[model samples]
Target: MSEITNFKGEAVTAKPENAADLEVEALIRSVGDRVRKARDLKGMPRRVVSELSGVSPRYLAQLEAGEGNISIGLLLRVAIALDLRIEWLVGGEDPWSSDVLRVADLFRSAPAGTREKVLELLSPEPPEAMRARRICLIGLRGAGKSTLGAMAGAKMGVPFVELNREIEDHSGMPVNEVMALYGQEGYRRLESQAVERVIAMHDTMILAVAGGIVADPDTYNLLLSRFHTIWVKASPDEHMSRVRAQGDTRPMAGNPEAMEQLKVILRSREALYERAHAQLDTSGRAPEESLERLLALIEDKGFLT
Candidate 1:
């Protein structure tokens, strides 16, 4: 019998029965390496990837350790969450050596302004023209995006939409129920679909999206290219107070370090939020006052024009 090295580099008799097993084992290790490399290259923590992909941290750990054989369905979810093509994860070729992937990598690492320039160069329409008169408000949950967006829409004589509500309507269930049933990966897919539906239905409207929408690069980039975006911001204290004012104490119900966690989130997402075309600070201000400023901002920015 011919001796061959198995996946673990141990010498073994090369039998036809185990040859297939060796190939499968090699494929598993290759997938695990690619997944780990992709995650590291994106600078995403395992927990963050798990949260976005709806995979458990322990499972991700095992996969990266080259021990867990993930399902195709779950692997596809991870690919989408990473904004990567599924083929990139499973293909036999080295993705890093591909010119297409190299360009994509460069684009992802480019500055926001540079990315916009590249988009303008590549797109058939100018960014503003693609956006038309549509506006999107993005920020933390308690940042008054919804309240101010609706008020602005009403006063400006345009349609207003809450993306979560859109997701709920499409799924025939509430947002929380959708999350409970479908997990983060499913919810994100629905969210992306909702954005597409809104864009197709309305060329001119005001839309408010959830805070975590920015976490998905593909969806967020689609938003940036299709709408005039604003970041509605408030202090951590204001964010907490506003949520509590709405009688939702989930942020502090059991988490004593909630405020600290909130701050950390804000700090982490600041760069992403800053990608918005404009910003409105609503901290220490009444909703009406903030709405007034938001309307003024829209006018000043000529967003509707």
Candidate 2:
């Protein structure tokens, strides 16, 4: 370059031969950034990670600063300590990509038959062990959970259960009374119990769940693991319309902000709702059309046990 005045100019002047060195430096910096970013996000102190990873704190600081040379064993130890994937520690910026790499790592370490099994589990197709033999309908109120759930079960020739009803039967109290007496936390405790009981009672069935079930972490976790959850997704307006069509004006009483309130609740829970194994959008579709879609999805996916 014409008289290097900055780092960029100096690199341009010298890097034709040193491109490999530059690439290595960039990789180091990227790894360092990822390590520190993940550590900071977890609110983990450097000393804590160092202790857990069995690496010295000084080395951890150096590693996070792109100045330390690490071995594969140390990298594995660090990954286990941070509950992260080595691929994430080394190169990827995408979390999902790291998850895929972690699966690859698992597959590589597994025994011969176990390798195939691991690959099956990692595939997008549902795994045998965790497959939803018992289907569950999950969504906000007015998303057709009950109607569609019953129809799907009927079509599939299996029993259908409403989890809220199960909760009442188990507790010997109305759901509203349970909520009023004990609050949301109390209701959720009962919900988890009901889910467990249902799983025990019937191995193959369809279950319609309460709209707010996803709000409880424990119960939601149960739903995720035990049931092949299908989210009955609909726009907030569509939800309110369905509710109103069912002649329920309670949600729309004198409050002018009823729709906004519904929207807020839907927005808050959308991410949680999305965790379901599959989603069926009922925004513009009629009940019959939506039921057909849901049934087709269940049939295509073979979620039936």
Candidate 3:
């Protein structure tokens, strides 16, 4: 728990002198933080939430600010009004994960089937089906996009472009340098610009995209509209093994929970990844075999002249 100022300006918690009490206080504050996030994400203002929850705006503010010792009944009412699970407020599950955020806003207002139909209607159809001139590959980092994209480009008589390399070239530095100089947000800003440039410059090419491009809905949707998207999927173990085989040990060097974090990210992103025109599972297969699968998917989708 955070300490509040006393009369003499000294900081103190309310009777939290024991370890268990401190833990309880911390949990209360954490729950408050989560409540605030859910409420904000649901587009519920304090006054509206208070009216719906029958808890005064002042109390709601205090609770959201982590200062109110709110009752369980009141908290439950708040949760219901916000359309959020109590377990999320209590931090059992991450409500802000991509998995939750992707659906939470929609699910709060509509059913799952309705949401799917809405998305299908909103998404634009590619002109060439899977034989689009702007062919793009998407997947986890260690997927065989680069290998297969190059080979596919060779067979199809078109150039292959790596979006990351394009990003680096556009930024006038390496991608790592861009991240270091401008941070992830800046890097992502540049990434969107680079995607546009790539689309404009290449009339017919195979594009290899960043693994986490799904995290950016705008760029990913742009790719979907303009390109024949193929998701090259591999098992979690294979993803880890492939990255490791490339001599990059940073994922596990200082973090023991790397694999679990990867699993969480994959779980959060799998649905978004499935939005691609086709999926190729590359587990236990050579790059050449994976390329064959990718070619088959493209051919089956009605490649044109």
Candidate 4:
């Protein structure tokens, strides 16, 4: 086998196979260190990040110390937990830089053997820049999309519009009444019309769509194509509490079968809900808390860019 050489041109021992593996490992360590540094700079603790990322604190510590081999999935969870991108986490470049020429130069001169390492050192684009991007909130009833979406829109300086309310406005009737009179099919048609109107009227808005929008494929697809969609999810227990708090007992309506109905509905729509660009679990969290998490996710995903 031919001998490999380090950057200093010193012949590397064949025992290590090549310098590339060492370089890659060093790159991972550097990136991990950067992540730790960034988190520290923000005055965030490892325990806080571990809670946000669903990563064990011990594992995160090991990762930051460059002593652990983490999976891409876990890395992504960490990146998102840090409100960062995988690219930004791996790359050492500033995430908020807008200088394309400088970025291009950095890319051009990277050694072919170390190119991937170089890319891994760059930071991801910041999410706040994408604040003007459209966001659509979808989920089952009582998911708190309306409350959270409103708060998110306010924080981002955008309008919060509810699709169901818009539908009511266009039809001049209460949503329940419209549904009763028009039936599910007719109500879906109306929902689609309202969605289109919202899409056309706003360049950027946070839309709190009705819970069952996904049941209408055309309307759901239209929303997906036109905006960044997030599903505000909650447990059945949370859903019941929220709905009850909103003064709507129609779900239970003194019926013992209500719980089973809810379970069935959730089970039937679980896959559809999972199709969202992001999922925010609202169970046991206040609207403001959920909004913060939603904003974080948007930022991490480059939606705010």
**What lDDT tens digits, residue by residue, belong to model 2 across residues 21-109?**
66766666667677787788678999898876677887777668866555666766677566666766776455546676576567555
Writing each residue's lDDT as its tens digit, candidate 3 over 42-92 gives: 688898988767778977777777777777667766876676555678866
If scored against the real structure, what TM-score would every candidate get? 0.62, 0.58, 0.57, 0.56
Kindly report which residue stretches of model 4 are placed more than 4 angstroms away from their true locations once superposed.
1-132
Compared with the true structure, model 3 gives a TM-score of 0.57
RMSD of 1: 13.2
lDDT of 4 by residue, 1-305 (tens): 32333434345443335788777667767766877876886689999998867778977776787655567667766776675556777776765455843665566555544544453355353323222378898988899988988888888898899888887866678998998999998899778767766655677788998777898666676676667889888999889889999998888887989988888999999999888888889899878788788889988986756
Candidate 1 per-residue C-alpha lDDT over 1-305 given as tens digits, one digit per residue, 9 for 90 to 100: 33444344345664436777777667777888988998988899998988877878877776777666678767866876677767788897887666867789898788766877888888888678999999999999999998898888888899999999988765678999999999999999889877877886789999999999999887898899999999999999999999999999999998999999999999999999999999999998999999989989999998999
lDDT leaderboard ranking: 1, 3, 2, 4
| Model 1 residue 47 CA deviation in Å | 37
Off by over 4 Å in 2: 1-127
| Native-referenced Cα lDDT, model 3 | 0.78
Instruction: Give the Cα lDDT of each candidate.
Output: 0.86, 0.76, 0.78, 0.75
Candidate 4 residue-wise lDDT at 253: 84
Error of 4 at 110 (Å): 48
**Where does the lowest 10-residue lDDT sum fall in candidate 3?**
1-10
